[model samples]
Target: MTTNILINRRSIQILRILVSGIFLVAGLNHLLNVEKTAQRIEQANFKGIAYFFGEPQWLIILSGIVMLSAGFLFLIGYKTKWAAIILMAVLIPITLTVQVGQITSLGPLFKNIAILGGLLFFILNDTEKKLI
Candidate 1:
């Protein structure tokens, strides 16, 4: 029983770290591609959502802020369930708007789907535990 408990704790720790790391890396990418990301957002043709978000500069910064917050929450396991859900909410719209119909190759498409799947798993697990 003790051994099982230890393993479960380790597993949770690993999952927490992995999920947090992914968010951190994604946040960094947004920072790195600020201009390009902003451009993409502008091109999303959300019928004014982009304008409301305020040009590429402000929008990119906002995205970075959101990602960083979510990443930090995940890292510290603070409100992790809500953090995961928020991250998924943000990622899904971004993915659908930006990557939809542009997947000429299977690799990128599968990668995005896999990330979504992982986020869903996190959300479901968190929900089941009432962690949020």
Candidate 2:
């Protein structure tokens, strides 16, 4: 008789770290392509804080840095709650202002929602560190 094992705690933590790596890569891409990211911001019409930042490009770059640092912190299990919160600060606005357009835009919207769920998981649980 054999029994199938579902996810153990180690597996969950590994999954969490792997997921965070995706944000790390995405954030790096944003920082690397500041011009393109700025163009996207302009196309999205997300200019509520343009006046405060003097340029939407700066805001975009700032968000990219936040995401990059947050992903690293989360992966390393250092101040993870704070990292998740900071990442959410960037994500929520972009999701609402940028992705919340038509109903057909469910793909990216749901993807972000799932990522938010993962961050919340990290926020609620203090998993043991493996590679930290």
lDDT of 1: 0.68
Q: What is the C-alpha lDDT profile of model 2 across 36-107, one tens digit per residue?
A: 876665655444544444676677678778888988988887787788788777788777655666366679
Displacement of the residue 43 alpha carbon in candidate 2, Å: 1.9
Best candidate per TM-score, number? 2
Per-candidate TM equals 0.70, 0.77
lDDT of each: 0.68, 0.73
